[model samples]
Target chain A: MGDALLEVKDLVVEFKTRRGALRAVDGVSFALKPGEVLGLVGESGAGKSLTGAAVIGLLEPPGHIAAGSVTLGGERIDTLPREAMRKVRGKRIGMVFQDPLTSLNPLYTVGEQLTETIRTHLPVNQAEARQRAIDLLNDVGIPAASRRLDSYPHEFSGGMRQRVVIALALAAEPEVVIADEPTTALDVSVQAQIISVLKNLCTEKGTAVILVTHDMGVIAETADRVAVMYAGRIVEIGPVRDVIKQPVHPYTMGLMGSIPDPQGGAERLVQIPGAMPRLNAIPVGCAFNPRCQMAIDRCRVERPTMRRIGATDVACHVAGPAETTP
Target chain B: MLAFLIRRVFQAVIVMLTVAFISFSLFRFVGDPISTMVGQDATIADRQAMARELGLDQPFIVQFWRFIAKAVQGEFGISYRVGRPVMDLIQERLPATLELAFCAAIFALVFGIFFGVYTALRRDSWLTKVVMTVSLIGVSLPTFLIGIGLIYLFSVELKWLPSFGRGETVKIGGWTTGFLTESGLKSLILPTITLGLFQMTLIMRLVRSEMLEVLRTDYIKFARARGLSDRAVHFGHALKNTLIPVITIMGIKLGALVAFAIITETVFQWPGVGFLFISSVQSVDVPMMASYLLLVALFFVIVNLTVDLAYFAVDPRLRISAVATRG
Candidate 1:
């Protein structure tokens, strides 16, 4: 953790809704080490994507970082000026999105997009940037990289376009990539290929990755460590294998149970009994107390912060280590 | 592209024919052309002689047939009021109309797109609010009123520019144009602003809205994330996407400019086809009116076709699928 390539500490992202200030990401904290892959697992509205957006300084307005810090290579970045943050973006961090089509501008040739990005962050002229773009296309597994350079994003197939997006993200050779649901919009058959492409490239380049997704299978395959977020906070964090085999938080347990195992046969997949609380309607104490099956009277009035429980960190009165203060 | 062009050209022919017939028939409702042909003191014999000369003595159907024949032969009949061929009159004034339209287009497109991007980028600013309000007024106010207001401000009160005419021209090669001459260029400013104000508002709002939409697209975010400067993101990425539709709209708007120029020319008394058109309308010069309508309609068709073709160059999806899909 001391040498984390990217560090997110107590990050809180808020949205100014018509009703009032709505806290979407409340005191979430995690760090990604050099060359490490951290999978952020959560249900919809879990603030996982918002965390990624905040780190990249694209927390769409009306939404903003209300508090906390994002440090890249030990330099605090969450509060950097717009101009400064823009420099940090492609030069230090790359971002891949949920949809491939949305991630690549349709009007530009893929080569133009890639070269512009390269020339922006790197000290490369046009010819050299183009060469790097071609190299990146080849690295991301696009066939005939040189020929693919002139293609508009739409000219490529869905999987191929996703590869192009990945190429664009990697154009500047940043230290970390925040891939928010990169595989979610791709077909299942192509998802594996994209995931492998992402994994191999990150591995080869020694780049850290923050992969935000709800797909447990993707986490199981690509993540070195996993963080489970629920209602705007990380409910648990540990090695992916440990979290999958023996989840410490009750919400994490429910999520793990919902991932159907083929060997489990014809049994109905287990689903958590209630929905995640709406922001305005979140409980006074523990946000999850209403939905937690093991919630106690104490749990209804007292929120549980992340606490060490065996090998994992868990935020639950019943499951986490004894409350040190109260 | 070949197929698309062929289909569009074929469709254009149908539209021109329909417009030609409608223009020819609409003249009947205005009553008579003779009142415009002769002086008040002229005799019945002089009027009859004029009618015979124009083939007005023939049956309505036969007169229409002769008109059609002359039109097919590319011989627009002599204007009853001016005693000159309608085509000749149009050709003489064509350059002035083209100049007015070209200047207006440049003014509208350049300013509209610039302000649109600026307002979109500064969405929450009070300046943007003021701009939007002014644009609304711009769109609502009639062109003649804008022309009058501009004339009063620049020509009457300020005495900064000429009020009623296109300025001096120097011979450029074999032809002459007011565009290059200093005073002539000054004369264009008021009229261009008046003629282009509505289109400016229209294109400005379109560019702003389109930029706003394109700015929110995932690719724009991706572009910004790539660390491109704010300028690069807006102009390089977002503006290009915004333009595809804007260009299409501009084509239709170019036609509007020509039609709207009629009112603008009348108010400014600028010597353009629109001025000729108004005089022809007043005199009920059927030959001139018919040719003008046809010419305007033809201009719209050709400009729109060019715009449609331009989409292929800007957007590969259209270019590729143009061939993939059947005509």
Candidate 2:
């Protein structure tokens, strides 16, 4: 409790579309400790990406943080001016994008991109930066790192390019890294390899990471804790294993049910009715009420905030709170 | 890479040969240079003697063969109006046109890119809108009209410059006195502005569109996210990507510039090759006219070559493999 590396307090993000100002990230709160991997899981349009973007002060215009504060290392970051925020980015918090193919500038060599970022945020001469770049490429498990530095982005394969992107993000050795769908763009086989590489590197450096993805397998494998988001709000937050084993929120339960069970007894996977609502069509009170199997009048009329249960915070009126057993 | 260069050179050679044939056929097909030369006072015997003296008395086939032979040997015969070799006249006037084109291109390129990028960055500003509207006018107005208008304002009304000619000059040591002289330079201002204005607008539009598109690419987002200043992200990362289109447009515009300068030269009455070309056309000077077309074609080929070489130089993607280029 005393040493929170990154803390996001009720972050609200909205977009000024033609229809109206739609809330993308609505009062989302979470904390990340040093060296901790917090997995942000949600269905499509859950605003998982938007929350991550807001924490880094990069919410796309006309999407902006309406009310919230993102604090890293006890300093408020979200309120900083653009230039100050920019410096805070590479120097304090780094980011990885979903698509790697377009991430690296095609004109520059892999080494040049790494070295430029390193030189910008760190006090290093060209030779030292080049050496660091090679070391980073090597650290990312690239073979013949020194030779590969001269190759352009096009010369690298998709998986390898993602690896280079990771290297570039970690160039400054920032306190935290927000990797948004880092593995979604890679092969399933390569996904495990990249995940392992990311985990090992972050763990070794003691750098906190907010791993944003829809893959439960990724959360299960890598995350110490997980936050489940639905309709731009967190529905559940707890230790990964506790929430996965003793699921609290109905939305979280439905999400887990949708994942196929390894034990073959249940022939068909459970399916939640209807789809996640669009920004305009999201129902009042509980955003998931229309699709929930156990929706009540109470669920349809009043929004629920996080209530402490057994080793978890579950947002639901029906479930109430977990009682301690004798 | 060698193969590409060889292929390009071969294509250029074929184009030159084609232009030569087209220019040669213009004299035979048009069939009135001798009539224009003799005028209403000259008799038939005088015309015949003149034809014999000029070797036009030979059979059409013989004359064609001789013309081709002489053209291949870098001769374009003599201009009746100038009473000198067409090649010599072209050589004398070509430098003036080239200097004008080069100066105009430099002005357009520098300012065009500056304004284009400036406006693109602040797209919603009223200044940007005004610049874009004025640039559209630059694109739509005829060069001769612009030339005359500039002359009207700068030369006639203001009495700031000479209205016609390249002005006088004397050779002094290594430097030329007239070309570099104050009055000569003052005479240059209107024509250069007229020649460059349209190109400036064209380049501005191209740079704006390209920069806008490039600014949206993922790499630029990544660059900004990585703590790059706006200047570095805009000019360094995004602008570099815009180069491919800018260079391509510049090459095409340069080729057009050589051809389009004729109207500007006529309006200014400047003693450049374009002005000479117009007078040659009116006087029915076939050799002079033929050489003028050939000269422009040559410049086009040269500009295209420069563009190709520039691509190889500036963009590593177009350069031979990194391994080959490393040396």
Candidate 3:
């Protein structure tokens, strides 16, 4: 509401598959405020990762932004050319990807890689860059950063390498950081440590973060707000505690119930029936109609618009707070 | 690292001994050298005396061992064709062949890698297509044909270079200044071009394919995502990653350059090891042939060893894996 750092509206991405034009991200919208963390949660093929990629202008070939407005720091980015977009990608918005082992160059030493990134966007000399690289490595909890800087990527364990990747992302000191499945490749213990580091660093620097992940536990731990995506559209969005305690959308409720609690006795995990529809074969009315337990005849005949539900927004036909129900 | 060197040297010695044994046995297969050198018109007594004098009447195994013993002492007897020490003949011609092969390799490697990288960076462009087409033509054509065609263009039509011979020499205190002199370099031009062009085409294609594969890696993507310029991403990151295959091909190509030098020397009549080898074979000069084979084999082994060492310098991962294996 108050000068969001990033505002994405009516974003739609499509791929030209052999069957048809498959809409991967259909009319997805979200915003990130300064110093805020927004969690985007969905299963594989839910288009959550695609939405993140579109914001960073890193969508692979055959998939492209069809209709959208991505405004970063009040500047329209979706319309910018490639060369200009490249400048904004690393200089203004940093990115961390999945699979740290493959993300880092194996031929270069860790220090060389970090220094290269520092020197790329900053006006710094070699010695300054090297020192900054060591400092960043130390800041990320890598022991003896000075001595370990000379080690190559292959020398580090998987968790340590992910830490290095995070260090690289933070080197540019961008206004926003987009992390896509950042901890999916790490162990549970390492995941907690990485999440803490990311949250603390972003809060310290006042950088907005768009954390794309499937693990709801990560959202519970870090995100200020949660956006639930299904079949390429965000179906539910609200404050993290509100969304977790009382999800209005049946799909969101089903997801929250699926996570097994350590305190709970032996109870059957609630699972939403039916698979996500294929992109080229989406249903006519609501995309989630087949899986919705409270779906009425209107839900099967017409798609629902996003309506307000007690300081929350949800795209559902039959369920919402009374004030905004239509 | 020192231990690796010592092991390589020991292996090289074994390889040399094997080559010497095989060459000695193979040379004998062409029939008795003395009988071949001396005509059938010679009298029976003359033949007997000649066989005894040349030690041909001894057992084959004893003669082979004797040959080896003399070879070890650097006494590769006298060449029947040149009537000089086989070592002396080889030493005289070795420089010319080495010079030609060295120049060709340098020319091929520098230009091949450059063109390969350029084409890969500009993939699907007109320049890349033209370069690839030209390289295909160069690779398909035989070196001899290319040599002949170049001589025709440069020596006959253009009159820019001499057709044959080492040309005039200028000696300065036992060192030759004429190697880089105009006339000397002119004589070398055609053969160097012939050898370089063929290998360059091969190496360029190899480098291009390797570069394309390296560019597709996630590390290269990370480099691009780090805001690296295209030059840094292509040359610094992608090219370095592709060098292992390039270095391996370069080593094998260098060894092949020496082999190609033999044929090139024959075609150009530039007085190199290939010319000496051909005449030695024609006159059945066993010691000279044996010496040449051993030297060439030794050169191949050394080139491969140097390449193996270079791999460690280029990629630290190789060094780490090597050390881990040793431990």
lDDT tens digits by residue: candidate 1, B1-327 = 677779999999889878888888898666579867787998999989988988888877787778778887898899887999988888877777889889999999988998999899999999999999999999999888888898888889999999988889766554457888889899889989998989999999999999999998988888888899998998988998999989988899978898888988888888888999889888888888888998899999999998988888888888778768864
Lowest-sum lDDT 10-residue window in model 1 chain B: B169-178
**Predicted candidate 1: what Cα RMSD to the true structure?**
2.8
Per-residue lDDT tens digits for candidate 2, residues B1-327, read 666778889999889878877786776666567788888999999999998988887886676667667877899889977789988888777777877888789889998999989888999999999999999999999888888888888788999888887786655553333467777787778888899999999899999999999988888888877877788788878888998879988998978887888988888887788999888887778778877888888889989989998887778776746446555
Q: Whose DockQ is higher: candidate 1's or candidate 2's? A: 1
Clash totals for all models, in order?
0, 1, 0
lDDT of 1 by residue, A8-93 (tens): 99999999988999999999999899999999989999999999999999989899999999999999998788899999999899
Q: Sort candidate 2 into its docking category.
A: medium
TM-score of chain B taken alone, every candidate: 0.93, 0.92, 0.94
Sliding window of 10 residues with minimal summed lDDT for model 2 chain A? A317-326
Better of 2 and 3 by TM-score: 2
Model 1: per-residue Cα lDDT at residue A76: 93
1 against 2, candidate with superior lDDT:
1
Tell me the spans in candidate 3 whose CA falls farther than 4 Å from its real position.
A16-22, A81-83, A283-285, A289-305, A322-326, B152-179, B321-327
Model 2 lDDT tens row, A73-166? 8999999988889998877888888889999898889988999999999999999999999999999999999999999898898889999998
Alpha carbon lDDT at B109, candidate 3: 91
Instruction: Write the residue-wise lDDT of candidate 3 on B238-272 in tens digits.
Output: 99988888999899989989887877888889788
Deviation in Å, model 1, residue A204 alpha carbon? 1.5
